[model samples]
Target: MSRTTPAPWRREPGLVGRTVEAFLSPLQDAYLRDTPSAVARLAQLRRGAGKAPEEVPELYGLTGTEGLYAQGPFADEKTEQRATVAVHTAVTLYALHQQSQRSRRMHRTGYELGAAVRMLMPSGEIDEPLRRRFVRVGTATSEAIRADRLRELVLLLRRQEVPLDYAFLADQLAQVQVPQLAPRVRQQWGRGFHAWRPPKATDSDGGGSKGTDTSRDAG
Candidate 1:
């Protein structure tokens, strides 16, 4: 949403990522503009979080995800399922993130899950408990468990007023569902966590100083 950043669609390279950006960007824009219809749509999507499509049939057409299946059938049903779930998870979490806030943008361009979580620490120091929570999220073996843990993390980010890149999150969610790709996804998360540093501070005289070092072990 920042004028300096590229649009979400342009930042995402995969189909699932593109789909998620397409689906949520407009709704986010409208909600920020105080459109009642978009706000109501976001609420409806939020309710579908961690829920099956059958359980929330009303959310079927609202995701703006027809592009996923429009091209043709996926190579396999599991791939298709993973893509759908990824889109749903990212969009729903975004809706939850956008809830109750109108001034700040919840769908930031480059804030991934790890960097966003890093912002939750006091003075940019990593807290052991938060680090453990993030570990559990990455180690989750089942989609159900992963979704539940992600739900908790999303809530934490919301409380701290941190924004995330839903496009990248969607891509990670989808890739993690694959056997070979899971490790890469986990590694990226770890890199993001350890590599995150607070923005440099500008001194009164316009000199810049680095932020506190946060690369210490969580243990």
Candidate 2:
């Protein structure tokens, strides 16, 4: 018999993940509280999605360099740029997710992108078109294309009122920028897709529960 190895998420988050949480949490909170700055930032970030940071000059001050280097600076400029792209993509996707739903928090902790897509299915079964979209996102040749594909999925998730973990997503997005690390990120997403199950109906009153936590804290 073989013992199962622990999933990556079982351990504490690394520097990049911590950085994402540090930066995104305050912005998320401010948005939830209806702060003017956060609202304007969200709009700007949304416009920056799937575009290069250089193209979005307005996104400069909002990147939160202090949070990115909270654990100390990156070893090189390339690494730093990749990390910035990840933070930008995750935050912008989150802005798109939160659009027009000011009363609801769309950035829920622990909800992976794949699992969030799974939640969109009515029967919790594989939906061909949706599955194809997920595949396209994973197979995207460029981070720009990947971000665009992710934006499409985010729209679907918004329709269903599903939430995602932007902090975890930022970490994954950062890893995906590295050739070797990209495979692991893809594997994590695959696991999330396979592991999700629909919410079980309540036996007590023969009705389903509302406002439930659907996230699986897995790799």
Candidate 3:
């Protein structure tokens, strides 16, 4: 049999590998200096996850500012740095995708991805109280999205089913920003307050007399 010719060598791998190396090379140095904690956390996540490194979007959001502060030797350093990190993290995650199937799946889900990124945060950066608050808010927000509560709230507000008095609803809405209050409450408040109408005249059929004070004065 005639000898098989060897496949021609491709330079793409080397070119791509060099580009990645050049991009991340500076991060390795800067990371070593300014935010050792961040570097350590990333390493720990990589090790603990036991898979290709995937950059957590939440962590990126949190650390991106700090990363910009540490940029070196490039005019578009911040953008370049972030892009490099994103690419590297993506490649790392891709490599581990098959091995860490569960994590890959979880990372694809927004709630689970957010939770996982939160887990990687340094404890010192966020005190216990703030951490708890963030967790509660994040959980509620996630659940609301999953259940379509926001849409439901908007619909209720449109239909005027909310029960709060105008002034009270206004005060509550101002304080809590409840944009989803039922339309009933909104309409009652809007009409009563804007038109200067006294509270809707109570039914006079002995159900309740208008202008009858219900409160007992404290001695």
Q: Residue 4 of model 2: what lDDT?
A: 14
Model 1's TM-score against the true structure: 0.84
Model 3: per-residue Cα lDDT over 1-219, one tens digit each: 001111122112222233333333343334435456535544533321212113244334322223323434446654444333433342232222212221111111111112222222332243454344433322332222312222232222223211111112112222122335334333432333222211244533333221222221110
* lDDT score, candidate 3: 0.28
Angstrom error at residue 144, model 2: 0.8
The most accurate candidate by TM-score is 2
List ranges where model 1 is wrong by over 4 Å. 1-12, 52-55, 202-219
Error of 1 at 38 (Å): 0.2
lDDT (0 to 1) per candidate: 0.73, 0.73, 0.28
Candidate 2 lDDT, 1-219, residue by residue in tens: 001112335335556667767777788788878999988888877897666677788778776645787667789998998888888788778888888776566776667777677667655467999999999999999888998899899998887667777778888888898999999899888887776665454323233332235343221
In angstroms, how far off is 214's CA in candidate 2? 7.4
What TM-score does candidate 3 get on C-alpha atoms? 0.19
Model 3 poorest 10 in a row by lDDT: 1-10
Stretches of model 3 off by over 4 angstroms after superposition: 1-19, 30-38, 44-55, 60-219
lDDT of 3 at 102: 18
Evaluated at residue 160, the lDDT of candidate 3 is 24
lDDT of candidate 1? 0.73
